[model samples]
Target chain A: MNFYDGLTFPAAGVIPFEHHRAHTPLYYGIQFNTSGTLRVRINRGREHTLTGPVCFITHPGAFFEYSLAPGERHDFTFFCFAGPRVQEYLRSGLLDLTPMPAAISREHKFVETLRELLRQRELGNYPESVNLLESLLIQLRRQTQISAFLYQTPRLQELVHELRAHPERDWDFEKEAGRLSISTQHFRRIFRRHTGNSPQHYLIQLRLAQAANRLAHSEKPIGMIAAEVGFEDVFYFSHLFRKYYGIPPKKYREEFFV
Target chain B: MNFYDGLTFPAAGVIPFEHHRAHTPLYYGIQFNTSGTLRVRINRGREHTLTGPVCFITHPGAFFEYSLAPGERHDFTFFCFAGPRVQEYLRSGLLDLTPMPAAISREHKFVETLRELLRQRELGNYPESVNLLESLLIQLRRQTQISAFLYQTPRLQELVHELRAHPERDWDFEKEAGRLSISTQHFRRIFRRHTGNSPQHYLIQLRLAQAANRLAHSEKPIGMIAAEVGFEDVFYFSHLFRKYYGIPPKKYREEFFV
Candidate 1:
């Protein structure tokens, strides 16, 4: 059987509380979706509370139930894909994903795009809608892993927070690493393991990313951006920007912004 | 070497188009934006005009060139992955895909979402962006065959155009296959082959998509939507609507109607 081929749910009128609890042979348990305050108790005796956006995957033979809060608007879309992949991830303990930067920057444009996609799906484009949902899911997973990696190392987390907080500052210094909990060498090693970049390298990537965004979305002059992102020398900043992005800062601005 | 480990493309002032083209390699090239135009030429010594969206895969050694028109803006996104699987797809001739519906639609959403993700990547969100991009590429390829099973047939093109011109009339008791120079059976097979559904099904899907747009973007009523799409019986229209979409006409109005 195709995935989600013969499945749908009642979304008629005000769906005060809609929950799917199936005991199907292929994949045990009916998938559930309801609006407003679904106090769900899984087989593990964990009471899951959903205030805004909440999603959880219930495996085979898992017992679940939900209740809604009066006048609290809640809506849901969900399904189960039966496969060994889920089992493999579980067995390998790889399902333990941490939060992603997008999630951390929850109010950022990234998550808003996702929420918009979800809202579009809820409007029911089905075939096209499912594609968007899958993209959101893929993004959600990636975000979780990012969060996991950042949370894995203290130095990495502090450095990332620092980068976000002060993107314009030139950051090729060991003082920032010293502020974190480890020796500079140890911090660099762990940071690279989790984020695949040394402190200086990661900082440059951050600055470039910020520079790219500015280049794409803003019309700020190269000199101004150089100063804004903490490069004191205009020529050096221009050189680094070009070397990092392959195009001179001004050209990137025209191509993307124009 | 890491996929983007240390690869740099630094250049001088606003990234020059020449520099942008020279440095970045086109790994998987496909256009998903329909109704857009692309002016491009490749190593084959051919000047090409592309309408609608297509995915283009240019090999490493292949000479590549493309530009979007001034007024005919193209909204598209792509990922560059150099791994065993991508190479496998290239060699398998499987990636030489036609714009089958499932894949095409998925590719549109995939690119749209990816553009946003890439935009936000400079926010120090590497792990998240990378992860989403990875699964997004997978979604793009998988949607191809699925879409092939679901798009409208070419035989219905003229009839659809006629219907759209005056959809208020009851368009029935007419067979278009004969006019299209094919047996009805063959036409249907080819139609489904190209469009992923029977001629009638395609008509309904089109009407539904149109109806959805009207309801969501305009203040059109159910009766008008039914009439506009050639459905005379309001009750029967609602029945078909619920049967295919799992909700009553009113709910579609409530959820999507502006």
Candidate 2:
């Protein structure tokens, strides 16, 4: 479920050793100085690797293993992100697989912007950090051509259609997982692995997004909208809206209407 | 800590109302409607009334209460942000407390941006929601002037000075909060209430920003640089640098030094 599984870089010391499939469905990154020669074993499947001091992206579903030879040292930093949408992007061939040197460049404005976002976030600028990271993630997927993942996964497509058709019905990981015939843990992992959230979280998000469209463009009371979206309590629905939108439902309605 | 105190607006048949306030301080945000008349009342401690869809920024340390009376309601949205910088801005007279209309003007781009940000979050675009929100928050803060709030609070001043004096300490918030004679919760809430982040989050940000400046301008071993900035672990430090700056420390040193 870690996007960083597909990624490896110099965050931790690159001890000179290798292990087989220690981390499954993960991104592995490594870095090395002149002290060691880096080696990798693509024992299981196919993956693309690039070597340089710039930034690059790792596509999802790609598998590989990496390490340094004996008496070798390498360094790397990586993390993972999960969800159904994440998987969708991976399979859609929407993300770029090329590795850019993991560093700043005047030419890669997107890269620079991503860096600024990361920097701002690290600065405890949570607001800035969140914004920049989200943008970077989206851009990484879009520019790399991984966006097709959503459209590519029939499971996701079926899920989306089902959710949209009955936005008011509650959803669960176990229920959906059972329907899909995968273990709950595996389903949860893949749900996050591919979509960036759990089944329940995804359903709420889809409902909320759709509700916003309706709120902005249609003439409907929040009560009806809430019920329509499967939220039993209008108050709860409004609360969710306010938390997410920073304004109350009535306020939102008033703003768009007269 | 609520920014929406000491202000009122026109309420049209329960057009959603949301407001926040913290006692030890006070702030005001006045709003108006698009086409109808907005009625406001400061019933407590002072009797004042105003109307419009206009918005006013409030500063901390002030005290007051307000409400938008039911009558004419139109589209409106507003929130108040306070920090040590906000108070400083208040005292310094950076934001003219002039009464303005409630019209959503083109010049008030941040306001619109704020609304849009809320919309995205409300829609539950989880992976995507955060970054957009942080950007809007940053933009909103940026649009305001920094006077006393930005420069004069003793705690904030101390925090800034410490950050500048030591560019490399892996600060722990609980310890800093202890030094401040307040609980961690209090410290974080207050710190963010003013500067938009907890104590430690801001410090790391300052350190990273400093490193970036060096990476862009100086020639130094990333290891040495990492140590100088209070980062005991060079590998971890560089990983952070790479993640935030999108380039490893060595590469950053190389890319910008030239």
Candidate 3:
């Protein structure tokens, strides 16, 4: 069956709450923790604390309750959707509507998609809304898989976080492995296993991503952006960007910069 | 059958050409005109000129050729995808792969989705790529329907373009209809039939959309944004914003602004 069909979104919104709780939602829900922290209990089981930039799902009649600490406001996007396809997916084990949340590595992308979804829905654009919902679900699923693997390798997770935060920093794989007290070869193996990219490749991708963001959002010069993203050679940076993005930096900026 | 499955994207890229022409492709192609105009002729039929911010699809084994003007560089994103599902859709009359292109009303959203698709493909994220591709196709289909209606009402189409360009202006529907030598009642009826929204509602949505874009991109005060978007009362603007976006402007900015 067509994946985009048969799913109906009854309601969705960006909401805020402080010390509030709700029980047993009538429909299946997908919640994105955008700010602060939220605690959710499924069927009175162990409470799962979801921090900002994470997502979790709740099934219909799951007896789930979520709340925030007193005086601490939590901002989140909640989507209520239900249909025969959702039921089929649930029954076939295609969807895991567990209470545990998954960390979102690309918060900006997640937020952008949600914003677009809201815009489409407001316009009564059904096709766009269904497509965006599917994209959001796919992103959540990918994040869940990544989080599961990262949970087993805490050190590598921290390293990955640092890499994302400071792609401009000069990173030496040997030094990173040394800090982790593992051989470089072992570090490479485990890093790839957990992140699906080698240390060098991952760092380069992060730097290129930063450069692309700047190219789209700012009036900064291409060479300056390259330097800011840890690329010492401007020509080499342009070449690499062309290889990755299928266009030259100047052309990309001209075509994409709004 | 899954809508996203069976479609394989063998190669895709952002390319620039000047005074260039190419003949029928081996695979089905979707091309977005990003910069200059593109002229395409299918099966030696009449040429269709697609200006920037439009998209067109090409079928496999079709005798099609496209060209760019001399000394005018055309930048476009080309995606090649083909599979059994595509053939099924074509056979079932589900996809209208005509040579004529459709205008993209929301160019920023279109470009953003394409960028995200490229990012996911680069990362080897299959699910995200599939979702994005499906979203893109759905958007194209919607655009085709809209263009067909808008093409029949050139006067109203011009008005719509002006409204989109300057939503902050005080718009009088009666005067707009008078300019086209039509009654206000008739204008509302035809506009709603063609655009799926009354003129007043459409203008308000445009204004609200402008305000939201400002909130996400600039650090301007909320009141200034409201005034800039033709809202005389900041409180009224905030109320409408909340009702439309499901969040206060302040919270939306705090949660979404990068």
**Per-candidate interface C-alpha RMSD?**
11.2, 15.4, 11.8
Relative to the unseen true structure, what is the C-alpha lDDT of residue A112 in candidate 3, on a scale of 0 to 100? 86
Native-referenced DockQ of model 1: 0.09
Across A1-258, the per-residue lDDT of candidate 1 in tens digits comes to 122233232221223334433221223111223334556665546666655444444444545455556566555444333334444344433332222112223324334544554454444333343334344444444555456666756456666677777867756557766666567787677666556567677666667657766777677777777777767788887787776665677776664452
Task: Write down the RMSD of all candidates, one decimal each.
Answer: 11.6, 13.9, 14.0
For model 3, the TM-score of its B chain against the native B chain is 0.56
Which residue pairs show collisions in model 3?
A: A1-B1
Best model per TM-score: 3
Cα-based lDDT at residue B131, candidate 2: 39
Q: Write the per-residue lDDT of candidate 3 for residues B178-200, one digit (tens) a residue.
A: 99888999889878755557898
In model 1, the number of clashes is 49
Q: How well is each residue in A1-258 modelled by candidate 3, as lDDT tens digits?
A: 132556655456776663655566645777887777778888898988877777788766678778876666667787766777676556633466752777788899888888888877766565577677777776676677567655545587788878889999999989988888878998898787555568899788788878877896799999999999999999999999886665688976764463
Better model by DockQ: candidate 2 vs candidate 3: 2
lDDT of each: 0.51, 0.48, 0.74
